[model samples]
Target: MAGYGRSDEEWGQLTSVGLAFLVERARLEKTTTYTELDATLRRRTGLRGFDFDQDSERAAMGHLLGLIVERNRPTTNLLISALVQYLNTNDAGPGFYALAVELGMLPRRSSATAKQAFWIGQLNALYAFYSAGRRGA
Candidate 1:
């Protein structure tokens, strides 16, 4: 939202596109890589500002994801970004844990196993919430 200098409408558009993609992934019980998600956002929103190589762009993406999580947290009670991860590692970046800590979903001094368990729980919860009665649909 900051430093990108995009209008509110543009942010809304990006959020809409990203959230829909993530929701669909949740429904399918699938995880998407950051690169794939970036491509989808670019394709859907025509926004080319999501390059993961740049630290600023990556932070912006994390901000976008944080927005999505904040917007949906009340209704879903889940961190949707758990479904998005690095392709090589099939795991989220450190920002994920930082966000969790910021959101009070995880402790600041948690162990690696605890962080992993929290992320897995969030993913499972998202899959269950989004896929409810729609797995075969």
Candidate 2:
């Protein structure tokens, strides 16, 4: 994921929630329309990148909300808005790990336990998933 003011340490490492969170944050800072939201969501999501966090997720949703409040393209605005809704309600276990597995974001082989590998694998998985799939892309 692209970031504005992040430290180098935070650059290539983030959870799915963390990555989702970042998109939320960026969308907030930049103005977006329904057309913009949909287009941006599809465009950015179509690529492969980082996993956002709560702050970022909220920020992206905030951008969509701004569109609705401002009366921009309500459809696109609401479309992204629903994503925020899904994120809020859905459990992360399945969505989180599945993406990691499907995208082949994990290490090829490691002695780490399932939990360790998952966490390590999750970083790349979350980034690819959110940046390249239906969730956003």
Candidate 3:
């Protein structure tokens, strides 16, 4: 299978490390003030303000990751639209997506297919990494 030029073992190592970092970052972001998070999301998604609570925003982050793995356009678009309408979202612009790129979920932005391939590769690697862990356990 195509990977980020890494062997299965290497990919697993990267995924484990990257996922740990992302989750911890999520937890930290949860602790920030709502006003601060709102401003950050505004800068990220170009939305005006946030109206949802911390819990909802946290849930949305998980939901976003799931959607990324699913790689369904309609569902992804629906999620994005809902977030825009409600002003509840994740720090994906500078957070999860960035990690995704580093983990080889996406090609560099200059690549022609970077946008399309990003989510697909990420989902593939995510499932691969977790499945490997489960088997080991």
TM-scores, each model vs. reference? 0.91, 0.21, 0.26
Give the Cα error of residue 21 in candidate 2, in Å.
20
RMSD for each of the candidates: 2.5, 16.4, 15.3
Give every collision pair in model 3. none
Give the per-residue lDDT digits (tens) of candidate 1, residues 77-131: 7788899898878577788899899888899999999999998998898888887
lDDT (0 to 1) per candidate = 0.83, 0.36, 0.36
C-alpha positional error of residue 83 in candidate 2 after TM-score superposition, expressed in Å: 7.8
Q: After superposition, how far is residue 14 of candidate 1 from its true place, in Å?
A: 0.5
Tens digit of per-residue lDDT, candidate 3, span 79-107: 11111111253322334455445556454
Candidate 2, TM-score vs. the true structure? Answer: 0.21
Candidate 3 stretches greater than 4 Å from native: 1-94, 100-108, 132-137
Worst 10 residues of 3 by lDDT: 77-86
Q: Which candidate number would show the highest lDDT if scored against the true structure? A: 1
Give Cα distance to truth, residue 65, candidate 2, Å: 2.5
Count of residue pairs whose backbone atoms collide, per candidate:
0, 21, 0
Question: Which candidate's TM-score is highest?
Answer: 1
